[model samples]
Target: MPNLLRKSFNVVNRVRHTASVAGLSALRVAKGERPDAVMLRETFEQLGTTYIKIGQFIASTPSLFPRDYVIAFQGCLDQTTPLPYSYIEQVLKEELLTEGQSLEDLFSKIDKEPLASASIAQVHAATLPDGREVVLKVQKPDVEVIMQTDLGVLHGVTKLMEKLMPQMRFASISPIIDEIRIRMMAETDFIAEASNIRDFQQFLQMTGNTKVVAPEVVEELTTKRVLTMSRLHGISMVDEVAMRQYCDDPAQVMADTLNTWFASLMFCNSFHADLHAGNLMLLKDGRIGFIDFGIVGKLAPESWQACMGMMQALQDNDYVTMASCMVDMGMTHERDKVDQAQLAGDLAKMITRIMAEDKTYTSGKPFNSKEQADELNKMMLEIVEVGKRHGIHFPRDFALLTKQMLYFDRFMRTLAPDMDMFSDARVSLLGSDFKQ
Candidate 1:
């Protein structure tokens, strides 16, 4: 009865945003009027935060979702209506007062208007009593409760689907949903995010990538719901015009960005999973500023080994080693039943196809060329298809790493037109203890 009541409430809320009872035939009209991907994107936008977050998650995983859905959800921006300052102040006071400090006692001033607004939290520029500049990341009001309710709904649905069709169990929707829940819960807690920022900064220093920097997280002014961190001033990485002004060598700046991030995958305990343009910036000092440490990725020891092997093979253009690594990574079924030679040959053909489409291995903008982009996407999908045909399933982190590389690829096309990404001596991937 309790579950029924909750489901009723969620459906009612969705109905208010999704549709209404105009007439008996109105439901059919609504279905016809909107295509699945477009309708889903629109509904997510209308349903607000949790759905928007789910959409963002789908947008990030092109390998997991249908290509058209991924393309459509990319249009679903994070920009939303700002919460009132009164609520923001309330959250700040409640969080800081728990530490035996009032807002006035700690912060000299906090901008009533937000510095920036995102799907989950809105940031406010603030100054400490000691004149230290910082930004307060305040959680949206009752977001935890809303997320719990929505996730419960998703979980219940997945359970039902699995029960109805056992193949759904193989797809592992429940575990994936649980993973998303844990990550989303972590994002809500500013303290954990603060730790992530510091750790990445440490990783940067350890790797000697002085050009890449993460913000300094302030502990005293931080709580689970609210995070205060040193404000980083810089031009966003996407602003090519401003980037040229910040540094004479934009190409080198971009290399430093990729090198630091790549190094983190091997050296850091966790790599920044979310590298969307919003979180990366080029500081006034010409260093890369990595902000918002929410959504990080980690790999098991064996996974890292497989990743290293794959990276080495990619650089050497050793298709056979690449094929073996893919099998080791569990990108295929029944390892003893696999044909190594055929897999390697298929990979070679795909690479040849990409090379034929665009020769600008250095200067060619594959990202901008529709023919090149299609060729690349088709090549990647074909590899996945062949592996799946052989009963291969890739690890989730494999998809995450692939997506981040695609982002770096776009950055290369824009910032570093003439540089070799993997083969460059400056582009380091090995950790201190890594044998290779």
Candidate 2:
């Protein structure tokens, strides 16, 4: 009976929360602001944590969303207000304490303040009983329950919208929400994230990679809601000034980072999906640190080969191979309808434009990051459109691969402007292929 009452209360609260945000959205629409991608993204941000995560999913999965919506949601921030330490402390005790154990028995010291706070969890600095520096990732109170209730509401609303608005039927909103729910639930499970970290650690050991590292999971203190990991000390890769104090060459760090990541695509159990500035650091020992294993991606063997071939072809300007590889990597209900010759010609034009832009980067003019990002996004959208014309549709993994490559490209431009990623002798794009 209590469980039933609690669930009913949760559903009512979720409806109230969503209605408040929807009212603001309706007001915006009434103000002559056409409901577009930008407005949709703004509405999602105001809807709170679940919608922010959904917005990020839309941004990263270009294969599933329109070009404009994908581009607009790229700026969706995952930050949220931090919960009070007392609340966090209650959760820690509920999850961590045993019959005979106490708070002091497990930790030497734990800071009351958070090191980093996100929508799902917040990280706090602490030391183990043995004096090992670690960070505790604590899931917010009732996060899982809230996510479940909100997703149920989102799914029902999507179905109703599709029925009322015929044009919305083609968007497949329900399935997208289902996928988001699965990913969000996984994000809340610290055990799964810990497994991802361990898999990465094993991959590093097998590859004999000493230049990169991930945080070690402290298994004893880890649970579904709480993950304890050995703390990593480093300077941000983008903080060139602080980085110079630890390492003389910032470009070398970028090279190591790129090489390790590329190799992981072929060798690791799963490659890190989200490698933003916050997740990457240049450690005091001059090695790259990859933190936060909450998100990862896997590619089938055939897809991996085709993706590598496509990247290699881009460097060589072999449009035929690039076109062929695209067909191999993509999905289509009617493969027989594709015209390879036309696809090749269209790909050649796009590659030629990119090559021309590459020359500008080396022409001694100042590199405008915003302009480069805008141009790249345009080209990516164009590529998708071109593929669609030929009855080929890239999968979500392809979008994930391309997005990470975009991040690497931006980093390389800032750190090693003269180097070409694919053509550079130092970068090992094919992990085992280049092994000695």
Number of the top TM-score candidate: 2
Which residue segments of model 2 deviate by more than 4 Å?
Answer: 1-4, 164-168, 315-317, 348-370, 433-436
Q: Candidate 2 lDDT, tens digit per residue, 1-436?
A: 9988987787788879889999999998999889999999999998878889989888877778888898899999998888899987888898899998888999989999999899999999999888899999999866787888889988999999999998998778898899889888989999999999999998888888998999999898899999999999997788777888888888778888888888788778888888988899998888899999998888765787787787688657788887888888755656667888889999888767775767543465544455654665666677777777777876656766777887777777677776667667777777753242
Model 1, TM vs. native? 0.84
Candidate 1 global CA lDDT score: 0.75
Residue 373, candidate 2: how far off, in angstroms?
4.6
lDDT values for all models: 0.75, 0.83
Model 1 stretches astray by more than 4 angstroms: 1-31, 98-101, 300-318, 330-334, 345-374, 431-436
Which pairs of residues clash in candidate 1, taking residues 3 or more apart in a chain or in different chains?
A: 331-392, 332-392, 333-391, 360-364
Model 1 Cα lDDT, one tens digit per residue, 316-353? 78999988988887654578888888888888887777
Error of 1 at 170 (Å): 4.3
